[model samples]
Target: MNQDRILLEETFYVLTKKNSVFRVRLTRKGLSLIKESDNQEKKQTIPTRDIIGCKCLRSRKSTTSCSCQSLPRGSLKVVEENSGEQDENDISAYLYIYAYILQNTKSGSCKRERTIITLRFRSFDKYEDNNKEAKRWRNTIKQLIKGEQAQNETPDTPIMHKINEQRKLLVLCNPKSGPGRGKAIFQDKVVPILQEAEIPYDLHITKHANYAREFVRTCNIYQWSGIVL
Candidate 1:
C-alpha cells in the first residue's frame, strides 16, 4: 500500500490528460460505513459490482445522491522515486467507475412501447499497483484484438478466400489524442487484420498540421475508397 495524501478533487490533472475515466472499488458493506456530510452513517450499501464507466465529473457528491458511482483507474508518476537517478515514472493505481440503471414511468396513455428503462449510472475504478496496471492493459489489448479478428474472419465468401489487392487506403493521423498511440495502435492492431484480409493500403506520413486536409481538397474522391482522416 503506497499511501499518499492525494486529494480526489484535484486529481483531474492526470485524468483529463489521459482521456480516461476514474473509478474506485468498495463493496456494499464498506460503503454503508462511510460517513456523510450530515455526520450520519449511510444506512445502505452501494453495490460495487454495478459500476461500468463514467463521464468525468467535476464533483463526486452530486452522483452520490443518485444511484451513480465513480472510481479511479490509473495514477500519474510525477516525481522520481529516488533523487539524482535522472529518471521518473508515471505512477497510478487502477480504479473502477460505477452507476445504476433506472426506469421511467410516464403518466396517462397506455402504451407499453413508450416505457423506457435507461442507465442512470456513473464510473470509477479499483485501485491497483503499477505492475498490475501494465499487465491489465496488455491483457485487455490482446483480448480486444482477438475478439475483433474472430468477428472479421469469414470463411464462406470467395472474396474472403482470395487475397484482395485492388484497393488502397491512406491513413492520416493526428497526434493530439491521448496516449499518442493512435498511429501505432492502427499499425499494430489494425494493419495486421488488413493484411490477413488481403486489403492493400498505403501509409503517408503528414509532415505538418492540416497537411492531410489540404491534400484531400484537391485530390479526386473517386480514386480511393474515401480518404481516412
Candidate 2:
C-alpha cells in the first residue's frame, strides 16, 4: 500500500457560509479548493495537516444554519419528486470540514486562520439517504486527519500497527524551565491545539538536570513522528 496514494476521491459542490463557491478535492496531501470564475480556475491547496475537524449534519427544514434555501443560484433543489421514492422532508445533508490554514498578515508574516468548507448533499431525496453519504466523507476525512485507517482497511482494523504508530508526537517539557510557568504555558497554549487536532502525544516532564538530553540519547526516537521541546 502506497501511503502517498489518494485513498479516496470525491468531487463536491461546496458552499461556504459567505456564499462562496469552490471546487474541492480530498487527497492525502491536502484539500484543494479551486475557484472558478469568469472561466478561470484559481487554485489554492489547504494542507491536510492544517485540517482540524469535520462533521456531517442533516439540517431540519426549519433551521437557518444550513438550509437548502440558503443555497446560491443554480444550486440543486432540496426536494425533487423521484417517483415518490423519498419518504421524508427531502432535506439536504451537509459535510463541514474545519481547518486552520496559513494566511499572510498585514505585517508580512503568516498566521493560521480558521476556515470551513461546507458541502451540501442532495444526490438523494431522502434526508437519511443524503446524510449517509455525508457521513462517509466525514469518516474518511477524520481518518486522514488522524493518519489512522488506511484506504483499504476496515474501521475495526488495528491500523496504527500497520503504520507502526508513527503518527504520534513526543513532547519533552521542562517543568522547571519557567520556574513553574513552563507547565502552565504548555497546558494553556499547546494542549488545546493538540486536543483540537486529535493528535496523539506522549508527554515527558523532565525531573532532573539533562533529563531531556538523556532521554533523547537512550530512547529510540524513530518511535515518535517528531520530538517537541
Candidate 3:
C-alpha cells in the first residue's frame, strides 16, 4: 500500500471488555493492536473491509471534571483543572468515543458464520473532537466497503465487450475569438448543449493565439476520452 494514499493513521486507546485500554494503530489498511511489553511480539491486524459499521457514543450527562481509574492500562486521562466552577455546556465538555463493529468469517467451518468483533476508543473530554474523529473513521470505512461492493457488482465479462461508462470531454474556447464572443458563445450555446446531453466537460479559455494548442501539448490527454474545441 502506498503511504501517500493512506487516508488516516492515528494512535487510539482501544477499550477492552475488562475495562482496560490497549494502544492500537488505526489506518486505512486495518487496526494494528500493539502489545504492552513488546511492539511486535503480540500484534493483531483487522482489515478495514471487515468493519461493518461504526457509531459514536455519547454520555447522557456532561461534566467538567473527570478522572481515569485505569491509567496503568494505557488509558488517556484528560483532566481540566480550574479554580472556579464552570458549566459543562459552556465548556462543551462531554464523554464520547467511537465504537466499531467488525465481522469476520470463521475458517474451516461447514456453515459460514461471521464472528463479531467490537472495538472502541477511549473517552474524550470534548464532544466535538470525538464526533469529528468518529465521523472521519466512519466515512473512511464506508468508502472501503463501497469499493468492495462495487468490485463485486461489476460484471466478469471480457474487456473487449465492455463499454466505457464515464462521460468526459474537454472544451477549449478562445476568449478573444470572433470579436470577444467566445465566452458568450460558450455560455449561450455550448453549455446548454452539454447540459442537455448530460455530458461532463472541463472548459479552458485561451488567453492568446495558439494558447489552446500550447495547453493541449502540455496537458495529460489520457484524462479525456474526447476533446472539443
Question: Best candidate, TM-score-wise?
Answer: 2
Q: Estimate each model's TM-score.
A: 0.27, 0.55, 0.38
> How would you encode candidate 3's per-residue C-alpha lDDT over 1-229 as one tens digit per residue?
3322445545553444244344555555665565565444566666665544443333222242543232344233233324233323332221222223343446643432232233443356675665566666655555453343222122542222232338478888877876789789889967854553346788888788888889889989778868888
Best by lDDT: 2
Ranking by lDDT: 2, 3, 1
Off by over 4 Å in 2: 1-11, 17-21, 60-90, 152-229
- Residue 177 of model 3: what lDDT? 73
Clashes of 3: 0
Predicted candidate 3, C-alpha RMSD: 18.0
Name the weakest run of 10 consecutive residues (lDDT summed) in model 1.
Answer: 113-122
Shift in Å, residue 63, candidate 3: 15
Q: Predictions ranked by TM-score, top down?
A: 2, 3, 1
